[model samples]
Target: MAISKLRCLGLVVMVTAQMVSAETLSPAQAPVAALDAAEPTVAAIAPQVDAEQWVRQTTSNLSSVRYINQLAALYLANGYAPLWQDSLATTALEEQLQLLALSGVSADFSRRYAQLAHLKQSNDWRQYDLLATDTLLAYMSYLEGLPEYGRGWLFGAGIDPSLPLPSSQGLNHLNSAIETGQLHAFIAALKPQDRRYTQLQRAIDALAQHSQASWPGFYQPGYIRLGTRLQQPEALITRLEQLGDLTPYQAAQLRTSNVRIYNIDLANAMKRFQERHGLKVDGVIGPQTRYWLMMPVQERIRILALNAQRLRLWPADFPSMLVVNIPAYDMSLWLDNKHVLDSKVIVGRPSRPTPLMSSTVASVVFNPYWNVPNSIMRKDILPKARYDRGYLYRNGFRVIRSWDSSEQIPIHTIDWRLVNAKAFPYRLRQQPGEKNALGRFKFNIPNNNAIYLHDTPAKSLFNKTTRAFSSGCIRVEHADDLARILLTDSGVSPQRVDELKARTNTRTVGLSNQVKVHLIYQTAWVDEDGQVNFRNDVYSYDQINPMSQKEEKFTFLFSGENPY
Candidate 1:
């Protein structure tokens, strides 16, 4: 389903810089209840009250409350006493809240927090017991929401983005933490567990260190080829140095040398920069690389932050899945959180970009017939057939008058030139063979979109670093091996897949369970080595800056998919 989640991500940040007005009016659905009258929570109360009865009455709407059960359990297990009343605990929570003033993730939580703050300040201390109980539990939601701020998650997949809520079994564990007086430690452990997330955090730190540095202006139309000489290359050297792409020794040599020629060393430095920025790692300072180089340091920092917030929304650990990253032109198969299959992929070109979605790998097709899309029939095949009459038959294609009937239509019976995409009534089918567009395998994922992952006959394209060559489907370099691995995983013996591949006819093998796949468009990610990687926004999703207030013209485009 389409959502404005990533779009909403830009509005706030992982850590919001929005100034908190402690004077805000009480807002949001209240938490379990308030903490001590001094701390923010759902309500204000005093001592000499029925803590258990008050908690039950105030937090009766446990399902509706963010973390009502967790809060209530903490109070209930502790004989209906306040949990976060410790000075150190309160101080720690305040710092976390202040750091996360970032309402970009969940504006709902922010409003709830403000309302709790309001209740804490109010002189009406009638519900002191309720306040003491909810203050800590409700604040727990805030801590859980920090790394995932601005990520409109459902809390299950896509992070289910629906977090903070606990199941019935978790209440026992919550009570144990309270019984052991480890609630503060328990709360402290409520951050993202992914190392990639922490890497993105480090990336932000690295960029922020130079946030105040004087950034060099973009050298427009800048193409400083190798061996090109310049009198003053100080700015160029400094910019590379500031980003840690260029080593100090190399940069210093370039800065102090009389002949500041773009040499191999400088080109190597540029390549490093290009690699990190998702550009071609050629030593040449080309237009694309120059454009990224020209971007203000602050803008890059924001971009990193935006990605970090997005990463936090992903499941902390998804044991099995296929993630096809569009921008990076790559696909990775993770099994038990380890890379089982890493293959280069060709995604849809800019004009027919692949839709960002999550689906499942339902089946495998060996020697699959290519059902040329109507769009391809109109735009690609028809025009060529009009001129080269032998194009269809010579290429092992058949013309079917109807999908159900499958009666072959004589190619020479009609005036090919007279037919256009709008008027074409026949379906084009390419016979499975050595020259078939889909080579040896097709990984099908059921979606409204016709997009799927499969093998391609055009093997040369996979060698390139930037491989956005497909019309819509993803073209994998190692489809045969991928199919075999998936088949084995699905309990379909390798011998069976091999047997199907040996035949001239098409075959389909359904998996025991559909492999979950998320075709995402992320431009920034942390690698296994803790290095942050960036890629070009091929889809232009980032054209509308995350921080910008403008919301127009950011419509979801999935024309490639058919409406179900």
Candidate 2:
């Protein structure tokens, strides 16, 4: 029975090889010609006496042992036939591999895949086969697993770990189809169907095509103010055209003028460029705008690809929710998947980053009391109290013995300078009023981090372009509008919402319908107008090691486990 099965597998492999050869020379031959040149190595590795043993041994020798079982099952299902031996299947796989390399999720994988492409042209068939399998396993594992850095925080607390992933069954189906010569269909099926993902993919391809030449640097030592003549403005014009900020016609017109002035046309283009880079949309060529324009295309591509991976982490079907994008310093509310409200928001500073999490807003509080955190109490308030005896009264703050106690202790009763941070037993609570830190309303979300969305008395700070001034919690610019939406959704009448806000005393209103809230830190995404938006990596999280290290980690995970 074993010999007969081996013979059958051999026949299938030969026939599949012939089909791949015929398909390569057909109307779609142009793209496959590159793969056709590497066909000798694939053909040389075609013949195998013990296919299952070869698979097991090759997979066992590698660091991707975690996928050994899945790889074994895949080969077994195919009757131990080699999947990539056929030219058509190899070409299809190469195309998908190229897509992943370009997708900025991992720069290391991209570089490694480029090396493997070179190896495919060599005469070493055995090495080719082993590396091919390893590459496939790596790609499959990445698609299946959570993003390397975010898994801990994403699945840590408040987030639902049960949220469904892009289907593993879809991958299984693609594997089955690849064995049967449905290579193109299977490859196409594996591409993410998400709209934003596809848009970013197009953006990456466009940028790559335009990246053949080195982008010009803004070399002026000082700020290029509006209507000022600058040296060599053609470089700036070419860059704006390349970035899709200016049309080719506009670029040509600007170039033909033979002038180096920062004119209205250039200013308009600069404004468009500013909008895409999450800068203040002013026409002036300031240091920030010049800095973004000087960034290389490869770096931008990496940003785009990393964000595409982030989109993969999102649930296949997103529900109506409030989303806070930390790097963008923006908050958006979605109802039935349609954007309802967008507002400027204040996020945590780099030292105290607002954590990425998901939770449901269970209730809203009007005229909310600010229960100051211990860290802030010790770091901020205690020093101020020590310097000024009347500081507590000026800020509407009172000292309490414990969180449960309502009685306010007189500030003059205790000596602030004598109180050490570690030995301090008192809690500080700010009274409900305009002078209170938590201005008027607070959206209560269930999270262990003690983070909530609230109004701020320091409303002037929201007007700043860089709004990362908070301790940790989010401060909404349009807090009243957000509160109205949340309250109205919870079946509270508009009149009742008004009455609740007008109350001088603090009161909590339970929501009839809890709203989901997701705090994400994506630095790149395609906006609704099909424009690719990039933000400064506020926390300097853009740099991450390649996926190769992840594979090494995987090997360490099951170091002594049996490969069977």
- lDDT tens digits, residue span 37-145, model 2: 3233322122233454555555454442334455556655655444555555567667667765765445445654675676566543333444565566555555655
State which candidate has the highest TM-score.
2
The lDDT values for all models are 0.64, 0.69
Evaluate model 1: give its TM-score: 0.69
Error of 1 at 24 (Å): 24
Largest lDDT belongs to which candidate?
2
Error of 1 at 133 (Å): 15
**Regions of model 2 farther than 4 Å from truth:** 1-80, 85-96, 99-108, 120-130, 147-190, 545-564
CA deviation > 4 Å runs, candidate 1? 1-190, 218-222, 256-259, 491-497, 545-564
Model 1, span 189-225: residue lDDT tens: 6545667766776777787788887877647355677
The lDDT of model 2 is 0.69
Compared with the true structure, model 2 gives a TM-score of: 0.80
